[model samples]
Target: MQSTRKVTEDIRWVGCNDRRLALFENLFPIPRGVSYNSYLIMDEKVTLMDTVDASVTHQFIENLDYTLEGRSIDYLVIQHMEPDHCANIEELMRRYPNMEVVANQKTMQMIGQFFDISTEGRTVLVKEGDELNTGSHTLRFLMAPMVHWPEVMVTYDEKDKVLFSADAFGTFGALNGNIFNDEIDFEKDWLWDARRYYANIVGKYGLQVQALLKKATALDIRMICSLHGPIWRTDLSYFIDKYDKWSKYEPEDQEVAIIYGSIYGNTEQAVNALALRLAEKGVKNISVYDVSTVHVSDLIAEIFRCSHLVFACSTYNGGIYPPMENLLADMKALSVKKRTVAVMDNGTWAPSAGKQMIKMLEEMKDMTILDMQLSIKSTLKQERAEELAAFAQQIVDAM
Candidate 1:
């Protein structure tokens, strides 16, 4: 049902959706929906840089047919082999018998494995710096290994100064009929999910991304056409700057992400108390997330952003609390590194929650444990609340 929307002069977004996969459309907590962005370049010869999901191949063809009435597709560039992006490649090629697939060695292997497409010497295998020219438009490929996939490559178009960046600057939510960053609330809706996606999916590929960034800076890029989400036709630097920081595993700001696990309401009160204290102390930014509520991926993103992290848990099974323990385990598995740590636990019988949390966070790299652990007995007394507030103060001061 999607159209071949023109994002730029020569660049038309022929991307389609997987609404059945997504939970909501154009909203936060993006559940089932995904966007498969395909682009058409009109030059002496035409090339389709990518294709939509197989689920929407019919609609995709309709869009392509509309966008390209009499022109024949000369090339089909396969950048990533993830099924959502490459599922329709075979169908597309079948529809355009003369279309030659341009991909890397790894991509060809994946193409053969994922579908019935025969490499059969019909592909134009490209290397790291290989270029493809369609008379007017020139495309330069950059290998991006482990930026979510090993076979992934990003294309830079010299004529339009556009980088057809496959999934590099993508996010979850579908656009609201406007395919630019300026059209949406970048700070509120997309930023966190974008960070979460990068952290969870491309977290380990910082070095590869660093290499790609260095190579890309040599070009005059005016826009970025990613395989998902909106095209970067305006203010491209914001996404690039974010990539640099996230790739470095550097904190996005001075904010603190407080993830708390509350058994009853006692531990929750302590977390709320600390959050209010942070707000009252004039520390502009803080995230007080319930481990019981927030997804672990989102938690990981916040951990990436905040220089300070706090955990509150209630005792269970004569051992560490469950939620906090799970978060810590996930963090360790992700190989997370950050600035400071704070732990608050509530244990009526054995005071093991605080001790366990402190031990786990102490093991994190480049992490300086704040010398404060608030362990509550049965309930939060007035005195304990004051102490928790002071503890929150100490964390703010340390930050």
Candidate 2:
């Protein structure tokens, strides 16, 4: 019935996991599913942090109702007004007739845009540095505009030292009954999904995230209660450092990732050759992905994780391959920069993809494209072995 976990003595994680949904935001695939976390703070006022998606309304309401024990919700704080977290606002209001919606002005406007309910008298409008005292715990609202959303704000509990991070430190996986980060092997199991989630969802707003991180540095936060993924109660710096590096567009590892767009496996063969060359040159942890087979979100996450990148593609219809072009467009859209890149192209006639890919990469900030461009006609011939060796040497030297 009520599938919930206790976050602290007063806060209960009344959230729901959606394993049936194939995609997150109908874009990225979520094989591990995702969690829509909504926390309920049991104080004298009985405040609810946020609401879950409509898809899980039944489970969410069951958990909320069981945790409330028939007590009414005095306040419903809206951290981020995104549909996934705000879908049940109207339903919540109907269930608890006197519950006041707590949010910033922009969130209030969005609430009006999304729902038909009247917020004339049943709204608590908060601003930056505003505090709400719900009996024992005091929640201080911090405005984090453009941190993925313009109206986003994070709440800090003064008593328990918990930060109700809206979506800042979130990941893309179900809780699996282990709601806390320390309960599971986070670094081994959850880091990749977390990277994918941040790189795709919040990668575009690095400056805003940096600002939020700056604000968080001043507060003595002991726990992070995000609206998705597990709660962080121990070793906070390990995750915070990751957020810091990700928000700054820094590579997580000094490694090479070779991504290829191959139509008939020709370009893929060339990528494999280059990866072998890199390995022979003492390069470790080299990652290779097929642009056509692998999801763009996964590629983007790899691009974010690796410091060095190799883009090998086969020219199609006298242009760059579709998958490779799409990946480059996504890289630009997400403001991906500050990395070293190498380009290789294969064509039966004219291999213009190498130059075109370089032009696209040049549009981004602080991208270092290697001068050793490897152009192959259909395949890597034996005569070009010397040239390939030289190209690999250039990359190793640059590293």
Candidate 3:
């Protein structure tokens, strides 16, 4: 009952897909499920790239057992210490008693913290620009300190020119038997989840990602094997360009997104009107979302994609709506910046959500808040048509 795929003549993919898990890290919803990718390189010294989560330990072991075919693992590379990727290190060590754990200094320390094992002579401590030779294939270790984790590093295979990227180009969603990017229509089905994954998980470490990309540029990489989602074996630039743009905090599309938090539907109605006005002005890439209904991770991903944003909310107890506030907190936490934003608030008594939201946005980096603010009392009445028109015009002019 082994499910495996071949990356090349010598490399085999032994990853597992989890469609039963409800959330990723118990925070973001993964309706499409997620994949825990682990690769095995067969050479003079058989090496296992990484291990999968404990939830899929049975399947992972079966895949490894079948692929190994009685040959013991010679080396276990620990690229990241996250539980999801490093859950069965002890199990793996126990299974291959003579196998050595190859990792950096920080990762070695984390091994002691996470498991009851002795790395006295069973570890190969590496640093930047270190190389490990397993027969003809040589893996060069490049330090990527905070690509998302402090102990992160990527391994480059000299023989096959495959980069064993830990999590840099990873996405959310289970692989439906299509392991390579060329096998599926990645732009049509997988881009959104990829954006969400990067925005929420690796978005905070933009500078570190940029550094990693620079290091990768020196290597002639023909394939990317991450510990999550699909492997890239063709048109590597397609995904690498995405990583470059995302790490630079640049919008992938010159689009506008209107996110609103409405209590009794008034605020949502106002957003609808604004969206139509923008459409009339020939803004074709406009998207509307109800923050109360959508997850903050989705909102953050949209915000990251769009160059312009509109936050429409209803004030509650003289403060910004809770969901809208939560979205703002996530944006700030993820280092979201370099965009234009417009604010709208509706409140029967003391309409202060607009000002409060503006205050919060001001604390972020490189955010351009439109000078025009629309304050609605209970509802946006017909008499305020001219004011609403002016507000929409301001956004159009900025765009």
Give the per-residue lDDT digits (tens) of candidate 1, residues 1-399: 448778767778887766666442222345635677889887788889888777788888888888888678999998998877888887877777888999999999988788876757568999999999998888989998877688999998888889988878887766557777777778787787788777776766777778788888888999888877777777888999999988887888888888888877788887887888888888776788888888777888888888888888888887677767888887776667756888888888776788887788777677788887888886778866678778988887897
lDDT of 2 at 124: 96
Candidate 3 backbone overlaps, count: 0
Tell me the deviation in Å of residue 158 in model 2: 0.3
Q: Write the per-residue lDDT of candidate 3 for residues 130-239, one digit (tens) a residue.
A: 99999989999999998789999999999999999998899999999999999999999999999999999999999999999999999999999998888999999999
TM-score of each predicted structure versus truth: 0.91, 0.99, 0.99
Worst 10 residues of 1 by lDDT: 23-32
Q: In candidate 2, where is summed lDDT lowest over 10 consecutive residues?
A: 264-273
What are the C-alpha RMSDs, in order, of all predicted structures? 2.8, 0.7, 0.7
Task: Mark the regions of model 2 whose C-alpha exceeds 4 Å error after superposition.
Answer: none
Model 3 TM:
0.99
Summarize candidate 2's per-residue lDDT along 30-89 as a digit string, tens digits.
999999999999999999999999999999999988999989999999999999999999
Which wins on lDDT, candidate 2 or candidate 3?
Answer: 2
Assess the local accuracy of residue 370 in candidate 2 as a C-alpha lDDT between 0 and 100.
93
Question: Global lDDT of each model?
Answer: 0.81, 0.95, 0.94
Best by lDDT: 2
Show where candidate 3 strays beyond 4 Å. none
